[model samples]
Target chain A: MREYIYMDNAATTPVKDEVLEEMMPFFKEKYGNPSSIYSLGQTSKVAVEKAREQVAKSIAAKKEEIYFTAGGSESDNWAIKGIAYKNKKKGNHIITSKIEHHAVLHTCEYLEKDGFEVTYLNVDKDGIVDLEELKNSIKDTTILITIMTANNEIGTIEPIKEIGEIAKSKGIIFHTDAVQAMGNIKIDVNDMNIDLLSMSAHKVYGPKGIGALYVRKGIKLDSLITGGGQERNKRAGTENVPAIVGMGKAIELAYENLEEHNNKLISLRDNLIKKIEDSIDEIKLNGHRTKRLPGNVNFSFKYIEGESLLLSLDMVGIAGSSGSACTSGSLDPSHVLLGIGLDHEIAHGSLRLSLGDFNNEEEINYVVEELKKIVQKLRMMSPLYDKLEGEK
Target chain B: MYSKTVMEHFTNPRNVGEIENADGIGEVGNVKCGDIMRMYLKIEDNTIKDVKFKTFGCGSAIASSSMATELIKGKTIDEAMNLTNKAVADALDGLPPIKMHCSVLAEQAIKAALLDYSKKNNIHIEGLEDINFDDDLHDHDIEE
Candidate 1:
């Protein structure tokens, strides 16, 4: 048997047993079109509405406000473009942070081609968006402000409540891509003043290809997909019933076990961070210390390449990511690292290890030991390290 | 995404470290591109007596340099100069499509060392004239 340890939960997670069990019935026995009026169809419709209520209660949202979509990317696209096209007369301006996911950034870029002005606010060295810069950047013509609750690369948690308050005072619609933050932490849409929120099921140990967008009551937006008037005609398509059912069950379980899970993850994360710091030299930690996610630990070694390190770890049956999984294969380093004031070389040396409920102490120790050896070996072959040490 | 040979070379590299007071030295790539290779050579009687390299790059790049040095260690200056990036990549099974530039760096580093060797000994090597060492960075930039 191969002994493997997976530490890339932020990229995606394995579906839990409960979620899989909940989805099994919907796939085979209860498989029916939720839009149809037949008895078999009504059973699926009831299950879908019950899942909607479960999703809403998890986030303290009203059931009517939750709209399903494909995943985080789609939710982001619909929320941004929907608001942009529907409220073009009210304003042609948008405000977002530089460290947003490409889903949000690329959507804003697409909107810019149609005469919409966008202001990308810069983040601090720790990847926190500057509330002052955000407040100053807003104008009378600014119709939307979209920022992420937690960054996917460095795992920095933003001041979303404060940002939501600012946007609320100005009456501009506020949206947050909570794909990384949804089940890991407590979020109340009413308390956060969030007009629109995006979330994905895969990040929270549910099925992929399904997510939700929480649009505040009475909010108006143009539709992205048009079909048989599903999702109250706001998003039109056959409902992804099994995935939705899985998401609801997964989210319910995530919150139920959140306190115990967070405690376990925080201890494991800190142990990994401390062991690496103590064993390695000339390394810098990325992201905020206490303000980061419970399972996120990122670091950059001075005289090592991340890809080589990742390969070495993989050979030992340990899996980790060099950066955000989306941008890993590109020769260019992560933009999120560059946005946080790291130079190109340091950015190229970044490694992110995200834990999950399945991880244990033994796995964490094994990972740290393997990482120490890999960094040492890579630095031995590094010409820059050789030059720097020779000068000494 | 590397072949077994590439992984073997990367895991247990052939010739690593620097040659002190070496006859010639060559360095290629830059910090911005996240790849840099510094090669050292000790030549005797028109033959490469010893070769060593230190590289900072991805897995393929380190493997390429290791393979390139192995290919030129016992060969004459003329034979070493004939070494191409494809030859080095082929010796290692093959590199990924995106990582072929690593092989290019290996070829450039060898040429750079040979150029330095010719400059010090005042030898009129045939192909050394066309390779402008100062502008070699343009090759990596343009090829991509």
Candidate 2:
């Protein structure tokens, strides 16, 4: 087998051994429905509650407020739709930024078709939501303010506390899609004044199917999946005991070694970024210099398409991602890149390399060396680059 | 989502770079659509002597351009003009359905260069008049 190097952790992460070990008993030895009236079922129930408490403690929320769901998309859907429908009598307006994941943006778009007003506030060139614009877009009819804690594409961290404060002062419910931020950044519901937050286990090295939504106490959201008494009569489904257990262990491990983990990733990320910048000319970094995720490195090479760059990288056994239209399977490239004021051509050339705990300095060095050669080769075949050479 | 043949061509595309002071030059697609292909040709005695291309697009687009240049390198103008987008795709083993438009762009690029060659010498090439280069073939329409 070829030597492989993975740098696409933002897309998904491998389940850790520790998390898997904690979940093994639930899958076979402790297999029972949490709602059944038996000793075996009771064991499952206790395991589920323990996971809830671990999730809540990680974000400083009440254990009862952490309701398990399918994944981040389901958590986001339930949060926005539940809040919007439950508070429809109060208002029909919803506010969100343009850089949110499709879970938030698409839900808002769907709400608009149902007669609800939505304001997609623009972001700055660094992908930060404008605080003044968010404040001005609010109205008496505004019922929810949903923004992402961090962008998935560019990795720019948003001003969540400020946005939460604005929502609090106006008595509007605030929700943040923190799927990309849950384990990477610290969260305190009360300290940030956040009413609701969405998280996924897979992004934090847990199982893929299980996630949690933090609904502050007394925030009565309409039940999204209504069929059973599960999730305290909110989200209804059989508990995924193994996945829930895995998530608990994963979140605990992430927070336990948060400082060390972040320090390693940040150094590797910055080293790679600096090396690329020094080696390549006419390349633009896509996110904020420092106020971005510790693991993200996004850049747009001036005259080459991202899919070609990604393919070239893959040829060398490196896994990366791109914001190019060809990779997106659509005519337009990443909306997040366009939201940050990049032209279509520039957006089509964007590449994202997200470091993780499994990556090391040796892998980073290998990627940098291979990337320089790939970019040079691709640029040589590009007509746009040919024009630049001709002019020179 | 590419075929093995496509990956091979993309990794080491044939006939890359521009032919300076060529008899014909043609460029198609735009930056907005995320693909631009430029083809240069060297013709002698009514035959294509040399052909090269420069492309800014995806793997399939680059591969299509590479294959198209190789197909027409030593063929007569009429033989090159007879090449179809389907032929180019077949030459590459088959592109993904969404990427078939890259083959279309390849076929158009070759004819476009032939038209440029015809216009420069003021010689009439049969069937070149019916080809409307302005019919912007969008990718969405070809995607299945």
Docking class of 1: medium
Off by over 4 Å in 1: A324-327, B132-144
> B15-57 in candidate 2: lDDT tens per residue?
9988889999998888988999999999999999999999999
lDDT of 2: 0.93
Least lDDT summed over 10 consecutive residues: which range in candidate 1 chain A? A323-332
Q: Against the true structure, whose lDDT is highest? A: 2
The alpha-carbon lDDT assigned to residue A43 of candidate 1 equals: 85
Tell me the TM-score of each prediction against the true structure: 0.96, 0.99
lDDT of 1 by residue, A176-279 (tens): 99999988888998999999999999999899999999999988998999877899988988999999999888888888888998999999999999999999
Per-residue alpha-carbon lDDT of candidate 2 for residues A266-316, written as tens digits (9 for 90 to 100)? 999999999999988899999898889989999999899999999999989
- Model 2, which residues run further than 4 Å from truth? none
Pairs of colliding residues, candidate 2: none
Interface RMSD of each: 3.7, 0.8
Q: What is each model's TM-score for chain A?
A: 0.98, 0.99
Q: All candidates: CA RMSD in angstroms?
A: 1.9, 1.1
Error of 1 at A124 (Å): 0.9
